[model samples]
Target: MAADCEAWLNANPVEAEDLSDSFISAEEDNGGSGGTNKNIHNEINGNWLSSSSNNLHEARLKAKAKRRLRKNSSRDSGRGDSLSDNGEVARGTPIAPTSPKSKLLDRKSRMGKGRGLPKKGGAGGKGVWGRSGEVYELVEVDKKDPNFDEDQENCVYETVVPPLDERDFEKTVTPIVQEYFEHGDTNEVAELLADLNLGPMRSEVPSLAVSLALEAKASQRELTSRLLVDLCGSVLSHSDMESSFDKLLRDLPDLVLDTPGAPQLVGQFIARAVSDQILSKSYIEGYKGKVDCEHARAALDRAAVLLKMSLGGLRIDTHWGTGGGQRPVIQLIKEMNLLLKEYILSGDGKEAERCLRDLEVPHFHHEFVYEAIVMVLESRGEKTFKMVLQLLKSLSLSSIITVDQMRRGYERVYMDIDEINIDVPLAYFILEQFVDKSFRMGIIGVKLRDQCPHRNRKRLVSEGDGGVVKFERY
Candidate 1:
């Protein structure tokens, strides 16, 4: 039995307890018999230990192999089936792959909810968590429908403005006409009028424009005439313009109360409008003999007279004549120069002053001052200078040219004195003398003397005895 146990132990060599010392001690105490029994016990113990360890290792390896197979099987299930290196399926049954969406649906179904989180506190069913509520079904919209919109629903709305009556028209149009008078842009006025719902009172525009111009200045009348021509076919129809003039003719008696020359001005407006085709030729013919009011008759007669003049249509543009600041700068300069030349040749101070007054440009009198000073500087004779000086004094004394204007004029000359010196070598000296005389005459202020530019006089050089150079100051 001991030999069989030892043979089993040799076949499966494994770690076991050391029994050699116990067996040796037993043999010494009980001879051959006790030694055999001790060997048998040791062999039994070694056999038991080896068999238990071998069984445990085999069980553990089997469990490990089973776990590996389960892991591979799970991985292959997700990818349909395991694929071999040769691109062949290595599976029992090929499973279909699951999409993420299907997987999500499966997960949701498993949780007993189709989509979204369970309602707060377990209240489940549609909107803001579940009591009975209105359910909205989303329906596809037809894009071919006329009222359909993708981004927003189509909406219809209407804005209506009350039509202007005669009184309302006057109130609304008064400021527009005034602004037109200032800017003098007919297109702007037309654009403004286009925005208004004039309705049946459209005829009132022409009459109101002319009436306002009559009460205002000559320039306003000219602008009003131009506006009538521009707005003829556009804003104001031919019929509207005719009706407007009829109203103006009827209102002449009232208009003459404020503007004594209203009849004449209206006549000019009518003639110009007719010539420009804004008013029909038959317009004046219609009122030829039926006119009752004397002012109206006078206006009609004046219109007739202007229409009969040669080149009347073209000439009527200058009927008002440019006045004050309205006249072109070049024209004003020419007229002023003529007045100065005439004054120099004739020595008539009153006539020169009268001509300047008639120019109607008190605002631009500084230009005259600059021109007169330039004339004096350019001229040779003392008499001509004295004459220009006398005219300036006369203007100053009469208050036609303000002291401020005179000072500005001298300052302008001072600013350009260097340029003037190119033409007139004695410009600085002449300017100084003129300023002194004018200051003493009270034509220029006392402060003007300090403002005048001083030019350094050139030094005279001469050779003295012993070849020495001497400098003489002017």
Candidate 2:
């Protein structure tokens, strides 16, 4: 019966890929499942229409109708290429369902040996066991391993372009000096210099900058001067005076001589430095000597020329015009002395000491000590009296005032203080302080012992009950 059915199917093949849908559609088109089921009903003696069989047949009819509708739409849309003439699904066509409950049905009804059966496992194709329980074997794919080879050739390369000198110069040096000119801080400039390995050549930076500025057009000259002024000021104001100030002092004369209008600017700076006590009187004096020596040498050279010209002289009258020849040295010395004397006279021991550090003459300490004592004694203020003695002690320790200088300064101060209505015996308090400081310092030079004024000996020995006056001379 199956062969006869197959022969009939071969004679009339379905256009759609699903053969089960063809059978269901043919039965439905003939009448319905009711007609076919009626034949089975009669064959089963009216008991053929069981609830399960009826339900199965109804689900099959619904699935067949859905397939027939899909096939009609595909044919109208020109998608009938998915159907084969021999009732096989074309490659890439989806498998159609047998019924809505296809998943619940046994595998026997869902899959069978047919033209639309899934392809067997070959060359990595996916496969399942056949209904007879034959297993599909899995195929292994071969892969090619990668091959690596190293190629090494001459790779060293040199820059074909010349080294950029200006760029490097701008990077390493120009920016630092430019910033220094913008901000007048020597320590910052020094740090920058150290970073660039130009620390030791610091003075050169400003000198070079000034030269460049001078060579620039007229419009930039003022800017050059201003930046140079700031740079020089920073160098002078640096706290590391031993290095910064001392080096500048050595380099300054040459800088001033070489650069035009430099002496005037430098002269102004020196004046400011002295006024502010940023530099010592000794430095000012040395600067003065340099200027004077240069001037004297120039003058002598002119005189020698004049003397030589006089041998053929009708008369050569050459007028000497003063230009950049003025020296501030002598004036600076007067200022130093005036400030020092004022501090001493005011009984300001601290200020006097500050001035004392700048004094060009060490012998002048005796004068300062004497004047300080006299100021204190005359004021007769207890604080002033103590300040003078402390100042003298400080001077002695610094070796600025020797034991002998103190002895003489003491006698002179005592006599002056005594003449001001201070008790003659009270004057011994001052002398006693000197003697004690001298002894404490291990200075027993005969000048101190011998210079003790004969008349003040009695005053020095006289006892007093004042808080500071009564201490023993020893």
Candidate 3:
């Protein structure tokens, strides 16, 4: 197009000298006539010449294209024949790709192409950014960037992709869960456990699930925690009400009571554990709840009997069953009494009285209020001999005396220290000035060596109303 425009301008030069000097100028009409005649003739001739030049240029282009195509066909035919003669392609000689896009495929497979391509910049004629491995053509962004609203030079344009959910970014989601329990997707797993249908797997669910949840919580396995909590609930539910009265003795456990639960739930759970013989033996014997009505007393006695029978199978000290385990049972009893105290405080003296009767504490020396503990080993329904004890084994004489409002109970030989509730300066005064003073005297024993024919003589002594003993001093 440029050449055609230039030719037209050169041929039409105004000055004769300029026309002669022009590269594309027409010949002058040196043999022609006047300026008017010459001007008309020149106009006619110029029009024809321009049309002729255009036609000739188009024809020349078509001929050149045909020649080049013919040469290419010849070269291809020759190469095909040579290849047909041999079994394999020549080394280092690249075979022509059958497809129009083969040129690109060949280049892509070359080693280190990625490294070299980026430096060369864009693929094809795109210039700067064309060579992205699997290239995407850049469409000019017609929208103005909102970030430009701020005049600061901090605007950064990142490659835009669709927003992704966790599934789309799992490589990243793994860590996201770990950051914190509340926010992380890891809870989804636990939630899934919560959703599990327990219809067929009810029993197994708790055992399996609780173990897993505990493990996860302990080991910090966030993914596993969901199932764990769900399982814990199931285990707790199953532990209750599955055992029977006979098995109750061995089934009760202090742990069942100690585990966190609604008060009622904990009590029920303990009852069930006891029924199943799952409680520690010592625990059964000593089991106590806040309430000590006939129901709890019966349960406690049943547990204690079973514990005694099942001692062989129990350790009750450290791991399984041992002597230390007996403490939990003691605790249960104490707890029951404490509950009774609450009843007493609440003006439910009738219930409190019932509790004292069930525990076999003297009717007046109610268990919680009375300082003495009367331990009776009854046999054959006969109340011949009695042994009195204190609830908390060791107590300072001072506190015991002040706290000993109820009269201390008595055994056949040992007076119930609880009898102090009777009167006078009370237990404190008795312990400080009377019981502790003379009670220290060792038991009286007659010398068998010189006691003619082993006759028990002069071995008897007695105490006065003040617990002071007088001896014959022989």
Q: Tens digits of per-residue lDDT for model 1 on 109-149?
A: 33233456554545564545444564767887888999887
Q: How do these models rank on TM-score, best leading?
A: 1, 2, 3
lDDT of 3 at 121: 52
Residue-wise C-alpha lDDT for candidate 2, range 78-98, written one tens digit per residue: 344454334566544544444
Which window of ten consecutive residues has the lowest lDDT sum in model 1?
Answer: 14-23
RMSD of 2: 24.0
User: Top TM-score: which candidate number?
Assistant: 1
| Candidate 2 residue spans exceeding 4 A from truth | 1-351, 402-408, 411-425, 428-430, 441-474
Q: After superposition, which runs of candidate 1 have C-alpha atoms over 4 Å from their true positions?
A: 1-156, 311-314, 322-327, 338-364, 374-406, 415-434, 437-446, 453-474
For each candidate, what is the lDDT? Answer: 0.77, 0.47, 0.35
The residue-level lDDT of candidate 1 at 413 comes to 96
> TM-score of the candidate numbered 1?
0.54
* All-Cα superposition RMSD per candidate: 16.9, 24.0, 29.4
TM-score of each: 0.54, 0.25, 0.17
